[model samples]
Target: GTLVEEVKGRRFAVSGSGFWQVHPASATTLVDAVLAGADVRPGDRVLDLYAGAGLFSAFLAEACAPGELVSVEGNRRASADAGENLADRPNAAVVHAPVERALRRGALGARADVVVLDPPRTGAKEAVAAIAALEPRRIVYVACDPAALARDLATFGRLGYGLESLRGFALFPMTHHVECVAVLARA
Candidate 1:
């Protein structure tokens, strides 16, 4: 695993290693996703599922100024780095646990105004289900895998959420890997 680095001018901290190595484009894509679809407001609660190194969590904390921003990460090293990265944010909470376990425990409480998910290539089935169950006002999904994104979007659609918009970013210029952002809202 490579060392985590903080993105300048943003509260996010991202790892330099992983299945999708953190590069300038990938980091920018994540920030762009948050900026385009967060729909955050003061006093709102935000959830960052599959929050690696506090990237989305930090962004939400800064952009939303919400009542709280809960970040969940399954990897130990990533979680530890997330804790260190988000330590300065008073409204942020970094939980070192699987997204599913955190959601199952109701760690996010009854409601969240905004939910952001940046899961792995496999997508986030259980996390998506939990978000649906919580019925957040807005959902921002960042995916590196289009197929998984489509599958998860179908599930969200079945749960009464419609895809509002979609955007693509060329994170890996030389490779087929790309970053996609999707906004979903209740129908």
Candidate 2:
């Protein structure tokens, strides 16, 4: 990873670590999926889980005013970098902790209006439950693995979240890996 990279015209430090490594096209696809049917209000609070370096948080910042978004990541370095990336965003705070622990620990309360999560290839099982606990109106999940996405979707279902839209992207090209973005709404 490069020390600094640009996404959607926003530049940030990657720290030579590929935490949020993904093709630019894939990134665009994921962001597009999240923004497609998103109903973000100006004063709505947003929870960004697995918010490596505040990628999607930038979007939230644009939609909501300052102090309306909380971005959580497990990696310390990535979280630190997120601090800098989201520095200009006074309202978007980065919490350096795992998504599950952060939510389970009550890092983010039930005040979130929307939640955007871009978990790793393993997907987020417990984290999904935690997000469900928040009872946000909408949830946008960016999944790198189909199997994990399926399992987590079931968990969301059990938690009373309904899958509204799902889109797949062949981001890796010839590789078997496909990125899927799913938007879920509370039922």
Candidate 3:
């Protein structure tokens, strides 16, 4: 099924498959948080990890006009959908590969200005190691689980990155689930 999500008055039609929730408020929070945390600049390269429907890809590509934006996703359908959703952005590219494998193969490029990863509830331990290797200037991580976020922050510490800021949102609206976005920069 196709669902419409409007973030900051910008509309995006996203596929509802792919084992993730296409919640509008969550999308807005993530997009806003990433932009605030990354402080993207023109001509900066950006990497979107676990880019389900290319939401952040569109956001980053438009913000950093003419800059390079590459989004990596493991699911085939979601990748295709992202490709279509991000079609208008000439600076964006969607790779249909898992983040770990893509990083191992050097597909997402090296040392981007910003890297945004919206990992699943289990967290992105394996992917963070690879993301840290990218040495991106800023890392905007969107996590659904606090424990996972904490653990990844620890890994980033070991890699010489320090958490710049963290913001929590009541994305689940009264549930125990909270969505958090953490920003990390080189210390």
List residue ranges in candidate 1 displaced over 4 A. Answer: 1-4, 10-21
Candidate 2 lDDT for residue 107: 68
Best by lDDT: 3
Clashes (N, CA, C under 3 Å) per candidate = 0, 2, 0
Candidate 1: tens digits of C-alpha lDDT, residues 1-187: 4654546475444455533344755675667667679788888888888887877677688776748888888998788778988898899988888988888998768788889998989999777788899889999998889999999999999999999999988867798887889999999
RMSD (Å) per prediction: 2.2, 1.7, 1.6
Ten residues in a row with the worst lDDT in model 3?
16-25
Per-model TM-score versus the true fold: 0.90, 0.93, 0.93
Candidate 3: segments with Cα more than 4 A from true spot? 19-23
Which ranges of candidate 2 are over 4 A from the true structure? none
Q: Per-residue CA lDDT of candidate 2, range 56-164, in tens?
A: 8887877878439899999998888889888988888889988888888786876678988888888897787778877889998888889999999999999999999
Clashing pairs for predicted structure model 3, backbone only: none
Q: Which lDDT tens digits does candidate 3 get at residues 80-101?
A: 8788878889999999998889
Clashing pairs in 2: 66-91, 67-91
TM-score, prediction 2: 0.93
lDDT of 1 at 178: 77
Instruction: At residue 81, give the lDDT of candidate 3.
Output: 79
The clash tally of candidate 1 reads 0
